[model samples]
Target: MTRDLLGRHRAVLPEWLALYYENPLEITHGEGRHVWDAAGNKYLDFFGGILTTMTAHALPEVAKAVSEQAGRIIHSSTLYLNRPMVELAERIAHVSGIPDARVFFTTSGTEANDTALLLATAYRRSNTILAMRNSYHGRSFSSVGITGNSGWSPTSLSPLQTLYVHGGVRTRGPYAHLDDRDFVAACVDDLRDLLGHTRAPAALIAEPIQGVGGFTFPPDGLYAAFREVLRERDVLWIADEVQTGWGRTGEHFWGWQAHAHNGPPDIVTFAKGIGNGMSVGGVVARAEIMNCLDANSISTFGGTQITMAAALANLNHALEHDLQGNARRVGGLLLERLRAVAAQVPHVREVRGRGLMLGIELTRPGTDEAAPEAAATVLEEARAGGLLIGKGGGHNTSALRVAPPMSLTVAEAEEGAAILERALRSI
Candidate 1:
């Protein structure tokens, strides 16, 4: 059955669409932190559907809410006043940390980011955009234009003029040798110099933690320093929190809070975990920037009652259970365990990230060269050991991205870590 499906999938899907493992397995269903494959094999899930399964899989609260809402009204054009939408908006606005904020929902992170770009360009009256080096926003035409990762970006023809800036990966870049403070200062100086040569840009969009660029991040307070410069030139700061929001980073509810010494950004975009597998993405902005468009715009399927109900339930569950606290505690222990494993392995170059969003960067035995083959072997071996993980990195997909659900238990973390240790050792 799986073989037949695989053949059909290959025939129908685009060749560029990537699949995992030596033999791609079909996931049938899921519970809290585990899933069953078509062959009736159960695996402990660590990546959680690219971290979209925020709380848990098949959560009763979210399932019940979806069922109840769909019975009444699933969707209506954005013409009438949506009570559920308004209620979710109120809830998000209160927690978004942007003063006098307005929320606009979209179907995915790509659309949310596209909406943000539209607003920022119109308000600043410029088409030029400054994006961090090795950052990825989304896959839409507008989003692709601003993406700096050459591996993900396919074309150079775009509507906006994009300038890639320095500072997303602190350990792999030109200024890796400097201390944290000096690194931040050098990046700021680089930003200042770039701004002088280029025309005024509409905004500087960045991911608080670069997701597809191997879960890399800049030094803390780097953005606050850059914000000081952007503010003087009227350039908006847009934080793309698609993967880092909703307390995935442990210490803060939002990734931008790491740089909140300056203030909240002019715009913030989020998705993935907000709906717990349901499609929910949106942008939050100050009233001034959100209301910049002269003409009216609305998403026909955005903020529908069904998705709002799912998101509301998921948000409540996350907050009520203090899943963020779990992420901090369990994730800390998991990180320490993985670091110990890496110390014993010579190919593991660095283990980085906070909270549940951790990554293992594999390299050659004694050199800095990326060991993509090693990563591939580890992934396959992990699957064989009844564990599921993910891969990412600008360097030939050489990093193992481990982002389990926020509700992960310490026992499960230990199990996943042991499986990963054996997988790495196998390679």
Candidate 2:
């Protein structure tokens, strides 16, 4: 039955939409941190549907909110005044940390980033954008243009001229050998040199932690240093928090806060977990940048009554439960456990990340080359052990991504870590 469904999915879905494992299981239902497949096999979910199931699976609050809102109205478009929409927007603006902020909602991270690109270009009056190497933004045409990872970027033709920048990944590159302080200085020096030869760029967009690039991040304060350079040149700094926002990083509510000593980003785009599996994406920016567009604009299904209700409920539940603190405590334990397991495996190159968004890079034994085959093996073995994780990285997709829901418990973390350890040893 699962194979038949897989065949049907292949016939209808785009080929670029990849599935995990040699044989994919059809997830039928879920509750808390566990999900059941069509075959009646239960698995502990660590990936959280690519970190979108955020708080937990089958969260009663979000379900009730969606049901109650749908009974009244699912969508009324952006033409009418939507109470839930306004409420969610107000909540987002307050937490955004941008002074005099305004919010615009979209159905997904792709559209959110598309809106951000539009705002920055119009406000700065330039078509050039600077993006970090090994970064993934979104799947939209405009967002893909700024994506520096060739694996996710399908084409070079773009509406905007994008220049790839350095320092997104601290483990590999010319500056990898340097200490934290020197690394920040080197990246900034490289940015200054690049700026000297290019046209005036509208903005420099980056992910605090590169999601599809396997959770790679630079030294703390790297962006703060870059902010200083971009400020001098009048380039807007846009933080794509699609995968790292809403306290997923534990220490910071928003990933940009890691560099907040200088100031918040000029524009912040978020999605993935905010709606807890509902389609909710948005951009927050200063009123000046947000209102720079000359004509009127609206997203017909964006910020609809149903999605807003779900987002509101999910956001409230996350905050009320202090999931950020939970992620910090539980994820710290998981990270330490994984690091111990990785130490015994030569193929495990590195285990890195903060909070619940952790990664284990697989490499060819005794060499720096990526071992995608090893990653694939571990992913399959993990599934066999009744644990569902994810894999992502550069062109080879060689890193194992372990991002569970923020509400993950200490016991669940230990269980998942044990399963992952067995999977790694099998590799």
Candidate 3:
């Protein structure tokens, strides 16, 4: 049955849409941190549907809200007044650190980033953008232009003149040998030099934790230093929180908080997990920047009633249950366990990330070359051992990404860790 579906999927889906595992398994249902395949084989879900299922699988609160809203009205477009949309926006604005903020909804992260680029360029009167190396923003044309990961970029032609910067990935860059303080100085110096060479960039957009870049991040306060530099020339800062928002980082509610000494970013874009599966994405900016455009703008289906209802319930439940605190407690334990196990394996080069968003990078035993084959092997072995994980990296795809739902339990973490350890040992 799975084979037949796989054949149909390949025939219809784009070739670039990659699937996990040597033989893909069909998930039939899920509850809590576990999922069952079509064959009824149970597996601990460590990836959480690419970190989209933020709270848990089959979360009752979100499902109930979505169902109730669908019964009343699914979508009325942005032409009508939306109570749920206004409520969710108010809550998000209060939580967002930006002063005098306004929100605009989109259907996906790609759309959110695209809106951000449009605002930045129109406000600053420049089309050039500064992006970080090894960063992955989204798949849209504008978002893809800013993406620094070569593996994800499909075309060289882009609408924006993008200049890639350093410091997003701290471990494998040219300045990796430097200490934390020196590393910041070097990256800042590089940024200043790059700015000197290029036209004034409209903005510098970055992911607090480069999600598709294998969960890599720079030293804390690295962006703060860059903020000071960009502030002098009025370059807007955009924080892409699609993967690191809602306290996934454990230490802070938002990933940008780790570098909040200067203040919140000028524009914040979010998606993934906000609706707990519903397609909800948005951008938050100060009213001045948000309203710079002279022409009218509206996302016809962006702030639909049903998605807003789902996002409101999901966000409320996450806040009420203190899922951020749960992530800090449980994810710390999981990270420690994975680090201990990784030390015993020679191919595991680095185990990094915060909160529930963690990554284990695999490389050849002696050389610095990436071991993508080892990552693939471990993914398959973990699946066979009744655990589901994900893989990502630079061009090689050699990093194991383990980001379970924020509401993970201690017992579930241990079980997933054991399975992952055995999988790593197999390689």
Q: Write the per-residue lDDT of candidate 1 for residues 287-359, one digit (tens) a residue.
A: 9999989998878998999999999999999999988889999999999999999999999999999899998
lDDT of each: 0.93, 0.94, 0.94
Two-way lDDT contest, 2 vs 3, winner = 2
Q: Write out the backbone clash pairs for model 1.
A: none
Measured against the true structure, the TM-scores of the candidates, in listed sequence, are 0.99, 0.99, 0.99
| Candidate 2: RMSD to truth | 0.7
Weakest lDDT window of 10 consecutive positions for candidate 3: 388-397
The superposed Cα distance between candidate 3 and the true structure at residue 44, in angstroms, equals 1.0
- Poorest stretch of ten by lDDT in candidate 1: 76-85
Local accuracy of candidate 2 as per-residue lDDT tens digits, 261-370: 99999999999999999999999999999999999898898999999999999999999999999888888999999999999999999999999999999999999899
In model 3, the clashing pairs are none
Give per-residue lDDT, candidate 1, residue 315.
94
lDDT of 3 by residue, 69-138 (tens): 9899999888889999999999999999999999999998989999999999999999999999999989
Stretches of candidate 2 exceeding 4 Å from the true structure:
none
What stretches of model 1 exceed 4 Å from their correct place? none
